[model samples]
Target: MIVSKVSKYNTLNDFLKSKTFMKIALSMTGCKNNRYELDQILRWAIKNKVPVVEESEADFAIINTCTVTSIADRKSRQLVRRTRNNNSGLKTIVFGCAARAQKKVFEEITEVDVLLGSMQEVITYLESNISDMKKCDDASLITSGEAFTRSRALVQIQDGCDNYCSYCIIASARGKSKNRPQKEIINEINKHVANGFNEVVLTGINIGAYGASLTTRPDENKFAELLEAIFEQTGIKKVRAGSLGPEFFNEKWYKVMQNPRFSRHLHLSIQSGSDSVLKRMRRNYTAGQVTDVIKKLRGISPDIAITADIIVGFPGETEAEFKETVQFVKKNRLAKTHIFPYSERQNTLAAKMEQVPVKLRRERVKKLQEVADICRSEFIKSQLGKKAEVLWEHSRLSGRAEGVTENYIRVRVMGARTAGSITSEVLTTENIDTLL
Candidate 1:
């Protein structure tokens, strides 16, 4: 059984093309991209008629991993050991951002049969090297690796980050930023659209800094123009962007917001609410500037679901600073907030800097989370009486079930069947999940 498989982010199912009967298991949740990685993997499995399993029930095991957090790095290492342990004889391969970030971690582990970095290189290396396991090095080579992803098909418009944000280890973990050929991006979108995906998300380490590394035209690397080309050329892929920093937003991109297909959701990284802390964390944008973007988004689309990431209790964050964050969130009417207590990661600038105690970080995270819940409650309640076009997804029962609206609201049903499923709009809204 010459089976082929990849870890979590292997979206295109490049390995599936092989003439092999292999059960594949992949997930995107490991790294937490703009789109769900596992969702894309499931879609690919369904399309190719391939079986994807949870543990080792087949010839091989692949893990696409993450290294954003210290915990994430540990999780990746744990999986490599577990996969081999469960199937003691199984051929296990570990790869992805985590693998790239912690090369030494892989080198230390004997369980990992093949170790590589990034989805693109992992695919290319596995294609040639997997046949004879011993010949491949513990650290796999990308060889000018180019790959798209499952989490909204992350077209890597750029890779790595140059911004030496004090707290961030990305500069060391993932190398310098590398941009992709704009033409190739268009081609990939066309292919995915042909395959039935209606949307595509642009992904990168420093997406805000795309096209800077180019030899052709540095000024031509404007994200707005890139988006213009994408929208004008193809109607198939709706532009669902991945992680976008404050540097990415401006008046020019604001004009592009007019496109209805563009998702209203914008995940801005407001790591710290305190202006002083922003400088310490080395985040490029100011608190005032981020608030301005939020305000602008509201003006353009009031219903737009604006999300943000807030790292509570950074080094030197005082009670007043935390309160400032709380006030800012309430004032701006944020739709969602991903709150993280600061962790002192090794080798990063933050680790060496004066640290915020873990207990303090936890307290700050909890307090901010409460603020987020209050805000989200308001948002959900607002949607209660309105109508939306949900995708009409599946259920765990005998018939079809609930799905999300374009704005990304999950409307579940006792069996709240959508409009097309049953000829009852009033019934659907009311929880009378009955079919007739």
Candidate 2:
């Protein structure tokens, strides 16, 4: 059987087209972009009458991988191997940033039958009989019509990044920044609303950078115009913006956030709290600027959830620099922080600089995490006794349905079914997960 399969499958396109229906498994190891890619692939498979199944019971496994950090790269490789090992005779296809940046690494795995860089490459590979997959490297982004979700719809309005932060590789892997047309974004949202998704999340690599390059008619704020259009055009009950950079904050955008249709929560990519660390990281905003932005947001809505990303120890960061970050977090009372220890990346400026010892980085990470835990508890405590809307997702806990609040807090409400979004009074802070 193995010999027969090998002889018949000289190319992936031929193998795919030969089958009327094949069971395939879809998996991703990274951010919302990967999730978006996976959904697009699933839609394409269904259009071709292919049935997607679990990795343990599949003829093919497609894994969207990440390479943000060394750990992420290692996990991406591990997952590809695991997918192949779990189901013998499984053909694996690896793609996304990890695959694009380190094609040779995936090629060496032997289990990866196809190494693709982008969604456009995956679609082209499936549609054509091209044998050389290497040529598909660095393929441009493709706009997805619909992402497969029943409750909350995530719309990718933009892709790629222009901000080449010192310790990052996404700019190279994903290529230059690009935005989907305003009309296309609106149409996609309408389709999801038609499919019964009440909540919509606008996501991208740098969503806050939307419409910067586009030709505006006259005196048009592109991001604001887009949001206003979504609110006026669709019946989507709740709209959420994805992780926006501190640089994207402006008076026009802030005014849009005041609209009742927009979600009260916002995630800013602060990267680091110390001005020195932020400058070293090539971040555009300082700790003070971030603080002022949050202050303005709070002034708009007192109960708003302002979350941020913070890297604990960058290269050459001193003890004083780390303390500055700690003080900043404590001073601003950030609702929650996505804390991560700085990881070195190859071919990046930070990687060539003086390295901070892993032991020290881990220590600082622990200290900051402890502070973050307190802030999260305080935020959740503040939410208690207030009536906020909860969009129930699934039954993760026993006798309770898990959902996220408008302010991005995950709470499990008793007897709350996973349906449309609803408003509920926060009775007790007990048993509610504090992590946002």
Cα-based TM-score, every candidate: 0.79, 0.90
lDDT tens digits, residues 101-120, model 2?
A: 87777767767787778877
Per-model tally of clashing residue pairs: 6, 0
Candidate 2: give the clashing pairs: none
Report the C-alpha lDDT of model 1 over 313-351, residue by residue, as the tens digit. 788888898898998888877778888888666777777
lDDT value for model 1: 0.63
* Cα displacement (Å) at residue 143, model 2: 21
Q: Model 2 — TM-score against the truth?
A: 0.90
TM-score, prediction 1? 0.79
- Give candidate 1 regions above 4 Å deviation: 1-29, 32-54, 130-153, 214-221, 398-400, 414-436
Worst 10 residues of 1 by lDDT: 138-147
